[model samples]
Target: MSSSTELTEKKVFLLKSLDGVIFEVEESVAVQLEVIRELIEGDCARPFISLYNVTSEILALVIEYCKHHAETCSGGTSATIADEDLKTFDNEFMNVDENILLELCSAADYLDIKSLFELTCRTLASLIKDRTIIEVRKMFNVENDFSVVEEKAVRKEFAWAFK
Candidate 1:
């Protein structure tokens, strides 16, 4: 029922985040996501993509990340830059406190960017590698919501690691 030209031409997409902020992004970028692309390519008249779990702050970060990668992929940077320089830039860009890093990881996962997800996971793993359970929980703001006995039991179970 649809012409091929309509499919190929750029379409504007409306993405609504959890905090009620609406973002208008290009169809190309939206299509980079399989679910969104399928929805767009479908014959639905009103395709309002609602991201119900992502906060406004997280959405902003995700948009910034996508825009940055899009620019990089579109060759906005100088070709003369050395690989080392690029690596340094990536390192610096990813460097953040644990809370922001966790949020970034969640955002990446929600956005379905596997590479960014993996990178953030690896970064968190690296940060936690040498930290104690208490330190890890503190860093992540994970409440010791468990009962005292349960908390002690878990701590005892990993006593060797803690010691």
Candidate 2:
């Protein structure tokens, strides 16, 4: 095997999102999706894969996250510097709108990208933890199924949680 090949010469895979947008990702980026890794290991990974559950917007974000992580982890830098860079990148990546954030979370889960899934979940947990029940519901766009009286009673029952 020739180790002299440049990074740009690496093999790439095509991923098609539900919205029919096609994205070309290098093998390093594609392997970050555990589902794709499994298919690759089993020799079943096609040159092009279709993801029916992910929209183009979400898929693009997920690919970006994976590509960044891959490059940072494999880059010629000290471990401390790479870790710090990734930390900063992840913090900034989670700054999208709530709807897009949730979509990215779901897409990450669907793609079996554990790191991205965990990041999104942690960010959401932090956001929800500091907000009131109404605020949390609004953030998630959850329709209130409980009447005001029911909500008040429940909150009174679990006053410590509300606090």
Candidate 3:
């Protein structure tokens, strides 16, 4: 095979968010974004992949996640690390309050990082699943955009929860 073909075969892409944040990710991981990978494999000459819809902050988080996973896969560290350490890292990484978590979920989804997207979604779901409506609203900073009557209607809809 030609060198360019080999390079393309081994090479991955780094995508930049609209706000100019860059993320270096492996081709294997980037391929998870099927459309982008198809374009890349088809020899689209775009130097930098642009994610127009994603913000820099969210992109940064996605980069962090992809970088970590890439490192793990590349054998940077032995797999001998204790489960506790892994759990601690996850906990610390997700320690941010609800709004940031929601943003991370959105970013993960946009980046097509299925595991991270699921992790964030599951975490958010778990957090709100057992909480009262008032608590959920406070956690998400969701203003009571509903009219008084609308609010009452919703409360009535979930009357079984109150009981």
Predicted structure with the largest lDDT when compared to the true one? 2
Q: Compute the lDDT of residue 2 as modeled in candidate 3.
A: 67
C-alpha TM-scores of all predictions? 0.69, 0.88, 0.69
**Candidate 2 structure quality by residue, lDDT tens digits, 47-132:** 67889999998898998899999999999899999999999999999999988989998898889999999999999888787787
- Residue 109: error of model 2 in Å? 0.9
Task: Please list the C-alpha lDDT of all candidates, in the order they appear.
Answer: 0.72, 0.88, 0.73
Sorted by TM-score (best first), the order is 2, 3, 1
Candidate 1 residue pairs in clash (backbone atoms < 3 Å): none
Least lDDT summed over 10 consecutive residues: which range in candidate 3?
80-89
**Model 2: lDDT of residue 89:** 100
Return whichever of 2 and 3 wins on TM-score. 2
Once fitted onto the true fold, the runs of candidate 3 whose alpha carbons sit more than 4 angstroms away are 1-12, 32-35, 74-89, 138-158
If candidate 1 were superposed on the true structure by all CA atoms, what would the RMSD be? 5.2
